[model samples]
Target: MTTTSPHPSRTTSPPHLEVTWTDPVTGRKGYVVIDRLVRGVASGGLRMREGCTLDEVRGLAAGMTRKEALHYDPGNRYIPLGGAKGGIDCSPHDPAADAVLGRFLEAVGALLKHHWTTGEDLGLRQDTLDRVLAGLGVESSVEAVYPLLEDPAGARRRLADAFAVDVDGIPLPDLVGGLGVAESALTALDRLGIPRTSARAVVQGFGSMGGATARYLARAGVRVVALVDALGVVANPDGLDVEELLRTRDALGGIDRSRLRPGDTEADGDTWLDVECEVLVPAAVSYCVHPRDQARITARVIAEAANMPVLPEAEAALHARGVLVLPDFVANSATNAWWWWTLFGDIGADATEAERKVRDAMRRLTSDMLVRAENLGITPREAALVVVDRRLAAIEERFGGPGAHAAARREGSRP
Candidate 1:
């Protein structure tokens, strides 16, 4: 892994803790950033990519904080946890990826035991991580929060059942995030008075989030015109066979060209932004959209399925160009919320119930953000920050700030 330094810019409010570990055998670097802690644990996922940096992990951790706080509902049984994130500066496709991940987990075993709860992210999968954790004698990725559960055994059973669920041949956990993204895109279109059937979408990733987003959008009468994977762009002006492509995609989001349909046109990966469409989803990597790439984006709405996919300046540019960006924390929040809702007994492991709850929550949240944006004459990201800040303050006021709980726990633990 590269030893590239983190970006100079830092979050206004510094994270509670940030740790960097270097694997002795592979020399690969891994990072963990706990942005905040609500109660006693924080939640996020671990991602692996060749150029992952501490700064990138920091931004994602902060985003998780907002994502958690945004879903704070007083009536719900599930309370939002704090935000944290882990990242490895190595490609997930590398042969030593699994070994490096295991070593990294072992290095951070103490944090996993008490403070940070994590799961899959960008270049990692849940099953792979679960196998790694099991080897380390860790019961679950989220075992840090077991102390807070009223029924730890029951909660674990519920989460396991939820993970066992399959919706349309895809696991329920994989689809919920994309379902949220799809609902957000659809909600934005409806608010703009555009008929769903007339909308064309170009998705920039073919992984779990993008695949499910394309699937749901296509099912809802939207034309999925193109899908951009690691290799190149698979496009069709009349709409491609999303299901066929989805079936042929590899774990790393590379599409199998041999399975392409007759009408599908393959193009250079760089031309993904050139494909004309009403909706564009950047579900692949962070900082993919810069100001230079902003001019070529024809989509009226960009739903973020990947964390921090758009650069700040580029988002500002897009807002100036009248492009509504459904911010990542708001758009892709359903997966995190769904896990807690199911584990906390707010909902069951049933697919239909999960869909209904996720759809309803995303619709309401997206609508609120858009309305606030319109009323305040601000960008959706700004509107969402406003909502997040308000909710976070309320939560802190009710349960005390993150530090208070940590201090109380420490005090109680000591003789």
Candidate 2:
């Protein structure tokens, strides 16, 4: 473990706990930030990517805190768990990733056992996490259990025996998260009195989340006229074939031009902001939309599927223009699904049931929050934060701050 260093660009207030360390074996650096804790519990995902930094982890951790407070327990029904995030500054493609991950788990063992729970994020796979936990002799609170109500016991048993990991309750990596974004986008459209059949959509990024969302929107009768990837952008007014595009996209969401045709025009990926569409879903890298991009945004509605995809200034600009913006926490179901399953157990007995449960929950929550915000004459983001703050404040008044188990921190760790 090494001492944490200061990053001058970080403008946010200090979190409850922030620590950075490097694995003695693989030399992989990692950061873990606990934004706040409610009744001694804080949780988020572990994301691995090259060039990832402590400041990024800190920002993400704070977003998780807001996500938990607003999306998980908006009504103050249960204790408001703090938000936390972990990041490993290494490529997902690194051969030594497993060793680095194991060391990370070991280093953060105290936090995991006591107050922080972690699952998958951008580059970390659940299967890897499962293996690491098994090797560490740590029991997972959210492991897959079999004998699904919708599946025959004998068949399920045979399948379970054949597979090394249980597949019964495991979510489809892309679908669960994308389904939430699609549902929220539809809710926003409905709130604006726009019908799905008439909505034209542009999806930025063609990876799992973006790919899945584009497919969902197409299926729901929305014309996905554009698909943006790291390599280039493909646009067609008559709507691009999502299935074909998905088959042509690389693992990192780069589209192969060889598979495209004459009718589709290729442009810079960032030009997605200029694509005229009723809906724009940014599921790509964060802060893709800066002030200049915001000024040229042609979409009537922007549904965030990536954390902090729109910078604060751009988001404010969109709001001022009367464009309904669904923040990432509210629109992205990636984190919500895992945390929800962890808290309430399985959604249902089958894939259909699970998907339906997720869709219903996302639609209901988005609708209620948006409608209330409109009635109260406030932006959706503001409304969400206010609701979360109210609940957190109530808990603080009742239990006092830091409720028992005064946060876990290295004795000499700096803020």
Candidate 3:
């Protein structure tokens, strides 16, 4: 279904620019939402999926803006990037998907020149990205292929070999993002006086971020008790075996049903919310935790691995219920990954070292942020916004005092 009207109550100010394009060849539609730009530059992911709507893209773009803006450095120094997101309302299974993506890219080529950079998201893949870029002959026009494309090192080598051009380090968005989320959850638990070793957790997705998050949390001494995906929700009171689940899970986040244990049972989607656990991780989609869903949440903490997984009203309800919510932008960890890669460079030559570096960075950042929020007696979401506003103010000072930035973000000015 098309979104004829935008969500009037956005988490942030309206985006600076919203451009919609219709592919003349396939009659498909695409959109690029630029929430705001830090000195005429912004970056986020590109998601291609059936039923993807403009408002969803707008929300994701705004989340990216907050994620980028929330980078906290000791010296008040960090790479400042604005938030942007692109999406095409189409299925990945369509035979003409490549052509549609190519056409959509071409239509938005002008805006992508240097203003907004995009990476990969939910329904998009690396091979599809390569095909689209090859068709457009605009390889340099792209930025990073993040959450959707994990093997940055291999992708970099392949591109350099094909074009004989130097390629820099490619950031592993999912791995680092997952690591960060796991770290944030543990930090939240610590702040709440919950013992890490005895904490139980339930994850709401089993794809890239969800699966990785489960594994990391398990390793950190948290019992991953349940997992939910498109197929169905599976629960194991004794705690699910994450490693075996990973081995048996399909690319679509479905389990082979045949591999289920006799005690394992399939349940409805909200089964996770009803599971008695100390930590609840919404790692799949936006608006999963609505007002009605709050009554089912038994967990003391909700660490958002997905962007905007909890609606604003739901968050308020969660707060009223004495639940500590680690906001999406803060918990997702993509922000930390971006900050580390852009500032510190490569952590080590191997994956183990890379994970260690991610864990360290996330632990420090999450710990400090959570403690500060607790001391201030404010929600983590409010604390995060304060941090974002501070950074944006710094950018304004550096950019010769913000001119029309305020005007461009007005709702009536969006186009």
Rank by TM-score (best first): 1, 3, 2
Write model 1 residue lDDT over 97-200, tens digit each, in one string. Answer: 99999999999999999999999999999999999999999989998877767787998999999999987677889889999999999999998888999999
Off by over 4 Å in 3: 1-13, 72-78, 140-173, 339-349, 401-415
Worst 10 residues of 1 by lDDT: 1-10
TM-score of each: 0.95, 0.80, 0.82
Q: Write the per-residue lDDT of candidate 3 for residues 84-172, one digit (tens) a residue.
A: 88999988778988788888888888777657767667777655676677777776434332211245454455433433321122224
Query: Higher-TM-score candidate among 1 and 2?
Result: 1
Off by over 4 Å in 1: 1-12, 406-415
lDDT to native, each model: 0.88, 0.71, 0.71
- The TM-score of candidate 2 is 0.80
The number of the candidate with the highest TM-score is 1
* lDDT over C-alpha atoms for residue 260 of model 2: 78
Clashes of each: 0, 0, 0
RMSD of 3: 6.8
Among the numbered candidates, top lDDT falls to 1
Show the lowest summed lDDT stretch of 10 residues, model 2: 2-11
